[model samples]
Target chain A: DQQVKQNSPSLSVQEGRISILNCDYTNSMFDYFLWYKKYPAEGPTFLISISSIKDKNEDGRFTVFLNKSAKHLSLHIVPSQPGDSAVYFCAASTPGYALNFGKGTSLLVTP
Target chain B: DTAVSQTPKYLVTQMGNDKSIKCEQNLGHDTMYWYKQDSKKFLKIMFSYNNKELIINETVPNRFSPKSPDKAHLNLHINSLELGDSAVYFCASSQDPSGRVGDTQYFGPGTRLTVL
Candidate 1:
């Protein structure tokens, strides 16, 4: 069973605009969420993370919002640049060690 | 310098063959993990080790085994490989379990295994 799900397989946005990617989870035990950006043939790089204690976390042009009640989280990138085009993965983990990841969403930023 | 590194970036083999993938981490973390990414790009944890001790072993098949000789190394050995085992395997390391102050995982570039 897939505990974490990314409904959208792909997304496209214009440069200098905003891009939003959504993720949902069925496991209530997950308290920490993270987003990673991956380029072709490269490893997934950590982007931003949010703890269950907080509803939102921001880093530069990236922002992540979490809604514990709905078990939903979203990653937003404002003024998206061409360099932001890549596959974004959403991962969640409990207090334990293992992490559950979504299927990932491919983002394309048009110049 | 690579924080996490995996050898044999690409491996292609026939079914029923046995192979191994080696991983090393230089971050001096106490915990390490193995994750598999299928064709759909869904990453799943297969095993976890803390201080060279096995901690979490997911529902992986018995054909797959993880060996950690030291805290800095974790290697995966697959026996009688099948076509379904083709995927990209990644190695990660963290400070420790329990989600303490420092538990952020660093991932490797990943090894793509293709079983024919």
Candidate 2:
């Protein structure tokens, strides 16, 4: 079964605007959540991560918010750049376990 | 320099043919993993090796085998290929598999495997 889910298959946003991508999970054991960005023909690169202990974590324009009670998480990109256009994957993992990934959401940033 | 690298970025083979995909990491990490992204684009873990020891083996077919020759290299071999095996395979490495707060995994460019 798919424990992690990204309901949105694609998103389009204007440059310099805020981009929000959401994710949900059914497993409560997952304590770590991560977001990865992949360009065409390239591997997914780690964008940001948040532990269940905290509700939010930020790095530059990327921020990840986690709500353990709701079993949901969202990635926010401020002033989204055209270079940020790619497929973003939401992943979750528990201690000593491999990551469970979502199907991914393709985000397109337009000028 | 690439932290994680996989050989033969693209592989096309016929059914029943055997093939191998090699992975190497220069990040000095002890944990390596193989992940397959199917047509649905769901990235699933196939196998994991920690210090050259098998730790996590998912419900993959027996035809798929993972071998770790050392801490820096992990190779995947398929005995019999099938059309269903067509997917993008990725190799990743982390400091450890304990899933610590800061234990981030780095991924390779990935290999596109196509079976006819």
Candidate 3:
């Protein structure tokens, strides 16, 4: 079973626009949520993360909002650039270091 | 320097062959993990080691074994590989394994294995 799910397979946004990616989870034991960005031939790099205690976390142009009640989380990228276009994966971890990942959402930022 | 690195970026072998993939991390992290990404791009955790101690072992076959010589190195060995074993394997590292709540995992470039 897929504990974490990214309903959208792909997303597109214009340059300098806002890009929002959503994720949902069925496991309530997962307290840590993270977002990773991946290129075509490279490994995924850490983007941002949020804990269950906080509702939102921001890093420069990237912001992650977590809704514990809805078991949902979203990543918002403001002023999205072409370089930001890549596959984004949402991951969750229970009480350990092992992570469960979603299917990933490919983002295309057009200029 | 690469925080997490895996050798032999690509591997191709016959169905009954045995192969080993090496992984190393220079970040001084105490936790290392192996993940498999199938053709459909679904990532699944295979095994995890913390400080050279086995911590998590997913529902993987006995043909697959993970060895960690130290906290900085974790290797995966597959015996008598099958066609279904063809996939991209990623090695990752983290600072701790006790669910620090905000620890980030660094992943390697991944090794693609093809079994005929």
* lDDT of model 3, residue B94: 88
Q: Pick the candidate with the highest lDDT.
A: 2
- For each candidate, report its DockQ versus the true two-chain complex: 0.63, 0.74, 0.69
Per-residue alpha-carbon lDDT of model 1 for B1-116, expressed as tens digits?
Answer: 99999999999999999999999999999999999999888999999999999999998999999999999999999999999999999998989563333567888999999999
Candidate 1 regions with alpha-carbon error over 4 angstroms: B98-102
Clashing pairs in 1: none
In candidate 2, stretches whose alpha carbon ends up further than 4 angstroms from where it belongs are none
Candidate 2 global lDDT: 0.94
Task: Give the chain A TM-score for each candidate.
Answer: 0.98, 0.99, 0.98
Global lDDT scores for all candidate models: 0.92, 0.94, 0.92
Candidate numbers sorted by lDDT from highest down: 2, 3, 1
Docking class of 3: medium
Q: Write the per-residue lDDT of candidate 1 for residues A1-111, one digit (tens) a residue.
A: 999999999999999999999999999999899898999887887788899999999989999999999999999999899999999999888887577889999999999
- On lDDT, who's better, 1 or 2? 2
Model 3 alpha-carbon miss at residue A90, Å: 0.3
> Using DockQ as the measure, what is the rank order of every candidate, best first?
2, 3, 1
lDDT (0-100) at residue A69 of candidate 3?
Answer: 99
